[model samples]
Target: MKKSIKNLFYFCLPLLIIYVGLEIFLHSLDYEPKTKNEYLEKNKNNLEILILGASQTERAINPEFLDFNSINLAASSQGIYPNFCLFKYFAPKLPKLKIVVLGMPFNAPNTPKEYTSPIVNHLNLAFYNVNTFGRATMPQDYLLFHSNQDYFSSRIQNYFRDGNYSNLNKFGYDTTRFYGAYQAANYNIGKINKSEIHIENEHNSKAIHNNARYLKKIIRSCKERNIKVVLYSSPTHFLYNEMRDTNLVYERDSLVKNLMEEYENLYFFNDEDNSGFEADLFYNANHLNPIGAKKASSNLKTFISKIIDNPKSF
Candidate 1:
């Protein structure tokens, strides 16, 4: 029996060593969270603006286009709860932070935790030591390779195959362009998954309310510091926009409006309906490509300036 146990341990030792080596190798590479982590660690005190939300705002705003010292902490599949948690953790570190721009995607107010992938949570823990999972995190939570084997495998494979480290730019923006069919029939076909359906079900009352509470918490946090809060919705393809449920979207807009009326430092920039981004500008039906991001970033810059320049004019 002892010999059998010893043989099993010996056989698994090499596999364990290989896994540890891969984890170290993955950590050494640059990624969105890794890049953002390093930058904030070095320059958080000088930061004047911080952008948080999911992919929509992540792809829309480019810190390079802004005049202020800014950082984009947004990532794809980032939930409102995680956004609130991140802001709560970093707000004190940013002495010069004057504005917080939150991208209000259709699902922002009711984004489910299930919608937030294990990889998103893993990256948050691995890079920032943040527990976006809303519980006491374990050691494995901070592991890039152990958190999600599929994600780690793909990342490692892609890294070796193409010598690529990340899909994000220096400011954590995804610059990948949309190259697939963009018609109404093909709009976000594969991207629309269980999360989308779960959010639209209208039966998730608890999650919806919790999301609102977290959002208000973020707004209040900024207001207490005399920092401005901008809850903006970037442009979505008209076809994708047209498919949204009127009631759900209106509820989200109403919540934002009410919050604006309730808070002195809150502002809402309604580009979701007004900004018409052409097909060439979209990386997907819901996200903008590099060129579109540049244009959007410029417009956002102007918006921020106008509001800050004359607070009452907005």
Candidate 2:
């Protein structure tokens, strides 16, 4: 029994040492947390509109177009979960907040279950504390060495390889034209030979329910503070629409319609159905080029003006 105990100690000693070493390294690096502290410090008081969602919303929304101060908290490949986490973090800080525009993409339902990367969670924890980490919609794997190690390694490699993480906010964003409009050209209606929306129908229904829940949370939070919440569907190429037309897209639209009916404060603007534009305006099936973005922005401005002018009509 003494020999067995001795053997166990020997086996566990290296792992314990390694774990301590890693924890010290992670705390020292100060890379995972990114500029969350700076973000909080800068925008705590000045921010008026908060945009949240995946890359599309990040790339699409030009805060300069609006009259109020806005910040794009959108991250690549993220969805409702991160958005919720961010809202919970910033909502208290932004007491003067007027609007929260949430971008709902058709593909949001297809997001994986383990969507929250460890690095992101770690950063969130460091900036927002353990409560925020616990509030993450994903399961906690904070103690998993493999998970944390992988996250740390990837973040370090990315920092050295990219040379600078600040590039993410360089121009910040431009209102002159949509930044990624060219990506939309891949889905021109005239060029399309095949038309089939590939997204799963059942999953789409689930996504819509998830979206409704997400919207409800945002709406409730905003209502408590007298902030307006608007749900806007950004424009996608006709081909992308063809893709979304699959089972999931239909269910998502139906769900949005249901939500619109149920909530007086929730508004849905269907840019996809808006007429008066040619197919060439699209950069691809999922985005609008510069021209399309301008037109879309104009349409949005008009819609917003009307809404602001007469909130009761909406």
Candidate number of the best TM-score: 1
Q: Write the per-residue lDDT of candidate 1 for residues 126-203, one digit (tens) a residue.
A: 888788987888877867877778877887788789886466666666566445444332444554432333223243
Tell me the whole-model lDDT of each prediction, alpha carbons only: 0.79, 0.60
- Candidate 1 lDDT at 175 equals 61
Task: Report the poorest 10 consecutive residues by lDDT, candidate 1.
Answer: 192-201
- How much is the lDDT of residue 165 in candidate 1? 45
Worst 10 residues of 2 by lDDT: 167-176
**lDDT score for residue 243 of model 2:** 53
The digit string of per-residue lDDT tens for model 2 on 57-169 reads 65555555655566666555556766777887777888677777777776565454245455555555555553333343444434333446666677567657974444333
Name the candidate that leads on lDDT.
1
Q: Which stretches of candidate 1 lie over 4 Å from their true place?
A: 165-168, 176-203
Pairs of residues clashing in candidate 2: 184-283, 184-284, 185-283, 185-284, 186-284, 187-284, 197-243, 201-248, 237-285
